[model samples]
Target: MTTYAVQRSLPGITMEQLAAAQAAAIEASKEASEQGSPVTYIRSNFYPADQRCTCLFEADSKESVEKVNRAASIPFDRVEEVLDIPPMQH
Candidate 1:
């Protein structure tokens, strides 16, 4: 499975939501992270906003990302899996 970085953006992030989402994210992340299932950081971060919350998920696939969002109940309005760029070796 190829690792994927997923981006989720919302139109307002709350403190309570952050906590909930964090837990949800962790759980979802664990699915791939544990036993070295190609999950890396499972990393998630955000700030209180009057009208938006932007989040990024580094994992294995769009489906995994969706699962995370669904688990978190974070009301994701958009998601984009990052495309890996080949490094140019000198």
Candidate 2:
């Protein structure tokens, strides 16, 4: 699976909306896994002050990531394939 970063901009996003979006994503993920195409929602970082968020996911392609976000009714600015770099040890 490849990592993806999905950028979303919500001017007035709330905790409730975030929870609903998560639920939808979970549902989509389960459905995809059952169909043999697994997509995992790794996590999300919310910037309330900026009214923006970046969600991370693991999937075969960006299209799968977009599909899950769409199924969850989540508005996103774009999706980009990302490479994860480990932190340097002191």
Candidate 3:
């Protein structure tokens, strides 16, 4: 599976909205996986000041990632494959 980053520009978004979006994404991913296009929702990072959010997912292709977002009714600007580097252990 390849990791992907879904970028969105959401102006005037609230915490409640963010939470709802995450929940929707999870549900949509699960549905997609059950339907055979396996996808996992990793996490999301929101920059309130910039009104931007990036969501991470592991899937077979960029189209899988985009399908999940579209199923969840989440609007995204771009979807790109990414390398996920873990933090260094002390």
Candidate 4:
């Protein structure tokens, strides 16, 4: 599986709405996996200042990630493959 980033511009979004969107994304990912597409929601970062949200997912292809977001009724600017580098362990 490859890591992908889903970029979204959510202007005027509230905390409650953000939580709901996250939940929807999770559920959508589970449903996709069950259907054999196999997408996993890793994490998300929300920037309140710019009203931007970037969500990370592990999936076979970018289409799989896009499908999940569409199924969840989430609007996104774009979906692209990304490199995920973790910090070195102490």
Candidate 5:
């Protein structure tokens, strides 16, 4: 499997909502890291209401990363899949 940076955009999402979602994400990351794979989920962007909320996650696949967003119940505009593969890996 390869590493992927999953970018999720949250639309019309407020700071409070983002805060709550972020709390849950932090907890989830702790749990998942303890369980397996040791993934990192990061929340970026200061103004979410005006701009889209961003999250960067390192996971093996898009499906797994999307599952994290869905499980967090965070309202998102879009989820971008960016695979991180190097020539050396091939």
Candidate 6:
């Protein structure tokens, strides 16, 4: 699986909405996994002022990520593969 970034353009999004979306994403991912299309929703960074969010997911392909978002009833602007670089401790 590879990490991907799913960008969502949500206008006037609130904390409650974000929480609900996250939960839905998790359930949708589980369902997708059971169907053989594994998708793991990692975490998200939300910008309340901009009404947008960037969510992370691990899946076989970007399409898989998008499928999960759609199944979760979440609207996303784009889905692209991303690289995760860990910080080095000094």
Best by TM-score: 4
| Candidate 3 lDDT over residue span 1-90, tens digit each | 999999999999889999999999999999999999999999999998899999999999999999999999999999999999999999
Q: What TM-score does candidate 1 get on C-alpha atoms?
A: 0.55
Model 5, C-alpha of 76: deviation from truth (Å): 2.2
Tens digit per residue, CA lDDT, model 2, 8-87: 89888789988888788878877887788889988888899899989889999899889888888888999999987879
Ranking by TM-score: 4, 3, 6, 2, 5, 1
Clashing pairs in 2: none
- Return whichever of 1 and 3 wins on lDDT: 3
Give the distance in Å from residue 20's predicted Cα in candidate 4 to where it truly belongs: 0.3
Highest-scoring model, lDDT: 4
What Cα-based lDDT does every candidate model obtain?
A: 0.59, 0.88, 0.97, 0.98, 0.62, 0.92
Q: Please give the distance, in angstroms, between residue 20's alpha carbon in candidate 5 and its true position after superposition.
A: 1.2
**Which stretches of candidate 3 lie above 4 Å from their native place?**
88-90
**Candidate 6, superposed: residue stretches over 4 Å from native:** none
Candidate 5 regions with alpha-carbon error over 4 angstroms? 1-12, 48-51, 83-90
Clashing pairs in 6: none
Which pairs clash inside model 4? none
Error of 4 at 47 (Å): 0.5
Sort by lDDT, top down from the best: 4, 3, 6, 2, 5, 1
Task: Write down the TM-score for model 5.
Answer: 0.61
Native-to-model Cα distance after best TM-score fit, residue 56 in candidate 6, in Å: 0.2
lDDT of 1 by residue, 1-61 (tens): 4544444564555668667777776776676566454444345545445455555566556
- Candidate 5 per-residue lDDT over residues 26-86, each given as its tens digit: 6666676677746567545545445655666766666666666666766555566655455
Candidate 1 — which residues are off by over 4 angstroms?
Answer: 1-13, 32-42, 45-49, 83-90
